[model samples]
Target: MTNLLSTSNQEEFGLNVLIIDDNEQITKMISSFLDMSNYECTVVNDGKEGLDLIKTNQYDSIILDLAMPEFDGYEILDALQRENPSYLSKIIVLTASNVPIENIQKFKELGISSCLQKPVDIDQLLSKIIDSSV
Candidate 1:
């Protein structure tokens, strides 16, 4: 298990994190890591299903992928922002896309929490979560 869980008051916070990615392997890896901690995580393989889950439940955070089948993360973001403004602050973009600088800037302007590239660093992700929770 990751060390961050032992140091943080994760149980008190009751973090609910949603991961939206089409890649099953990536999703499993992320879920396993999160489950080892105090995070209550839900993974969805399709963007449409991810968006539906988001609308149906409340989450402390969301890790979104740029590309997926049925619907893309961008569309899901737009829809969520329109329906639930508060969720805007909780969304984090986690994708393998080589996005442009301008696009990254736009995401920041839209109030996304953070953007994590592909081959995500476990340490970095844990740090972000711990920091955000605080």
Candidate 2:
């Protein structure tokens, strides 16, 4: 997993990914996998903190969980819609709850790159991340 790439090629392939989830284990697993895949990862457990980071830093992709405490994903999305709509294209929403079809459509309307359920396949997630970045 420590096979580092050349500095130039790394810049071409590596993406700065921010993963925001209340579940520590999920974040750790995703971050580790992305790190091994040559993507830099930042993990945030609190939605409020995650929102702050989203506002202050630029990341190539954001993996966001819809259910979280102290300012949930909807709040973050709403805030971004108001002030940072461009970032929506780089966001992949993940939720365990059974979201309504209308809400799912809303997500697409908001320009989210993808919406995935919990227990997502790592490979598919990686594919979405790559595709969205492209």
Candidate 3:
């Protein structure tokens, strides 16, 4: 478990969080952490299902993975950019791939809150979640 002692935020609870990742372990770990921290979490390991959920429900924060087999994160992002641009503020990109600076800049320009590399510290991820939801 992450050392929650390092987080400075006030007590928080019941934030609706959606985690969309292809990796089961990653999603499980995050969902477990969020649940332990009193967040309402929904996890989808399939990119298509994740996109569907995004279209149908609003979330406090969205943790998105860049790589998936069928319907990748970029496609979801593009769809959101066209249909619901405001949701961009709630998006936090989590990827292991080495994204070029220009693409990272593009994600920033598109209003993505954070583009964190994989193996991210759970505290840092929580911080990004807190900051972006605000």
Candidate 4:
């Protein structure tokens, strides 16, 4: 198991992040990047598990994928909206899907901070996280 946070900078800025995606590669890649950047990260491979963690833990941000088996990102979003609206402010949707403009607008209405397409630009994502953390 990977260390969730870097002790090197936890005292200064312990940003905890949760990454929810069915793609193992994507989760690992993001986690590695965030860990190196001094952010604590927990990766979940399914939406259900992700939802559970969100309910029970505290995180500064969430990186979510819209497509997954067992429970898709929409369902997770809906659950958060209904059961824990505050979480909406911390989510950043990261999906490879060519989502419709209407759907993207709806996601914004649901209070997601941002919707980013896959093959994510690491610098942009890091910037978004930093901006949101403030």
State which candidate has the highest lDDT. 3
1-134: candidate 1 lDDT, tens digit per residue: 35766766756755788889999998898889788776788999999998888889978788889988679998998897788767767777888889789878977887777888877778888666555444
Could you tell me the TM-score of candidate 3?
0.91
As for candidate 4, its clashing pairs are none
lDDT of each: 0.81, 0.87, 0.89, 0.86
> Which candidate do you rate higher for lDDT, 1 or 3?
3
lDDT string for model 2 (18-95, tens) is: 999999999999898778768989999999999899899989899999989878999999999999999999899988
- For candidate 2, list the clashing residue pairs, or say none: none
- Cα lDDT of candidate 1 equals 0.81
Candidate 3: segments with Cα more than 4 A from true spot: 1-11
What is the model-wide C-alpha lDDT for candidate 3? 0.89
In model 2, state the lDDT of residue 67: 89
Q: Against the true structure, whose TM-score is highest? A: 3
Flag the better candidate by TM-score, 2 or 3.
Answer: 3
What TM-score do all the candidates reach, one by one?
Answer: 0.87, 0.89, 0.91, 0.89
Residue 7, model 2, lDDT: 38
